[model samples]
Target: MSDDATPDATSERAAALGLTSPAAEEGAAGPVRFAVVGSGWRAEFFLRMAVLMPERFAVVGVVSRTAERGAEVTARWGTPTFRTVGELLAATDPELVVVSVPWDVTPVVTRELVEAGTPVLAETPPAPDAAGLRTLWEQVGASGLVQVAEHSPVMPAHAARHRLLQDGAIGQVTSVQISSTHMYHAVAVIRRLLGAGFEPVRITAQRFAAPLMNPRTRAGWTGDRDPVEASTILALLDLGEGRSAVYDFTDNQWHNPLRADRLLVRGSHGELLDDRVTRWLDGETTIDSPLVRSQSGIGQDLDGYDLQHLSFEGQVVYRNPFVGARLSDDDIAVATLLDRTGAWVRGQGEPPYPLAEGSQDHLISLAVEEAAGTGQPITTEREAWAG
Candidate 1:
């Protein structure tokens, strides 16, 4: 929720969305200084954001396991790289350290950082499996120095839908159907839209295989013309009190051109299908409103090609904070996580996403995999972090 308007303008927009206006921006502060602990693909996202907005974030250093990898990162990003966390920390004291390593190594690095009294922004899952998650929580859950970089809830479209739900535009949200992402990512979106906390859930799932043509991926086009077998997992997560979520995902769905993302949020008064909201305003009147996006660089518009804002029924619900950065929607979400993490570390805002929340999301996701493999219904048990 970034705005370049005056206080009056911001207040009007907030009133339109039925929300109270927030306080004005605080006094100017220096850029957030941080470091990275890995040099993989995910590590580059942080470096890229810093490159795009140098005044907002600063990359103090990066840690790579091998000297060759460190040299490559230094050459590309022009940021100094070290061989270990110890060397990076010894050289520069970063306010926060981002752990973007593999799943198995994330917990170890996070623990090391926590023990050193350094705040951490860990990548997704936080651990590899259930045992690792429980152990990680038992070790660092009480430290209050860890936050997970989960970005689904802050994505533009999802953010607008969340505002609509919170404003009671569709009454109380009862269930959500997510076919956009898989496993933990999907679960995170479901839980956020449902306003669900750390409660027990009953999960049932199954996997199916079918022949589909995936001509594109994150790398680019595959150039192959043949169809290959891919797996699709469907699960029903029963979060008691009549609340539930339907999780549907196909293999490589995130990058496959053959599959389109879909979402549905049902409430007592009406339902939201993707960007459209259909609800009854009165006993005899029902209306449909579509979430419209204002993108620049279209036709004669000269603000460059970027997303400016998202509005429904003439009211702005979501605004792009990094408008001039020209970032994709996914990148925007990740950048939001980075910005919020910086604010949290400086005591300027609340924690963005904590380790307890990330652990629960992965806990249910692992259950989805197990239920599909064993053809049985799995019920989650209370964990130490639930307290």
Candidate 2:
């Protein structure tokens, strides 16, 4: 959940629908019911959260178009499943609807929930394109509903990074470089750091593709489109100061798999590099650097995950903040969002990842795609990420 304000209308609407418990009405203590709209890989994570933190989340119902898939999840999780939105909602009337279905199909589920006025926490890339996003905006406007994106950057990793930047750990007003084969996460990071709101500007590029599906997933999976892997470059507009984030996308490493994430911040005094988020001072000294990861997790990252040990001031080593953090990436993110959501339920706060910010993520990715396709820099001149 983002730290954005939830207008009174939105709040009242959410409250009226019994979407959640209001502070004054907390006497009737029952778990807040939630429905998972898709039963794919991501759906499992949301379901996992429900089991991990049963006090906070409940899997009231699940919706999957395919009976086989739905039954698989229902059997494994011991929850009811349905084949359609109407059936799921009619059965559970969940307060929060978690949409993890296909990008293009998400709008359909979103419309149903928003029309029913259920608070939504849709999966990443809520829409396939700007046009699809517009459908959601229109639906919400037509009926006034609350929804949030499930993008991780809106959580602590980004919140802490923003706070630290504001705290002057690396000093402000500079530039940055980021590379990713995944466009959405990269754009989300840039938007969060740049403090720009959602809304893609007129992008100037084209897209490239190759053959898409494999035996695991038939053509029905990817709209029968090719190009499993892609490369993209994103640049910010109206760059005066503050920060600039450069983005890169590469072909998905099917046979040649490599997970590459690097970040470098150029400051007036020094720089910081990579996921370690290490800081440098006076061009030759290190301030705070943590030793990187060495353990491997199965099926966690497409490419096995490892955080390389980082060095500071040419000698001193730092401790791993995550050594005892006891939080998975998904756990850290969704948990924080739930914290904000709980606050909203109690009338203490508002939604974390708002529609506008989610749209900004979409636009940024679109801009990057356009740029990569056309071989020109697309400019999001003033598309501020409203939240």
Clashing pairs in model 1?
none
Query: lDDT, candidate 2, residue 104?
Result: 87
Cα shift from native, residue 42, model 2 (Å): 1.2
What stretches of model 1 exceed 4 Å from their correct place?
A: 1-27
TM-score to true structure, per model: 0.93, 0.69
Listed per model in order, the count of residue pairs whose N, CA or C atoms clash below 3 Å is 0, 19
Q: lDDT per residue, candidate 2, 211-306, as tens digits?
A: 433322322333333345444344443334444566545454222223345656555544556534446566577766542334443366443342
Candidate 1: give its CA RMSD in angstroms.
Answer: 8.5
Please report, in order, the local distance difference test score of every candidate based on alpha carbons.
0.87, 0.57
Task: Give a tens-digit lDDT track for model 1, residues 1-387.
Answer: 111112223334334434332222333777678999998998888877766666677788888888777767765666778777887888888999999999999999999999999999999989999999999999999999999988888999999999999988889899999999988899999999999888999999999999999899889999979899999999999988889999999999999988999999999999999999998799799899999999998999986788999999999999998877778898899889888999999899999999999999999999999999998999999888898
Candidate 1: lDDT over CA atoms?
0.87
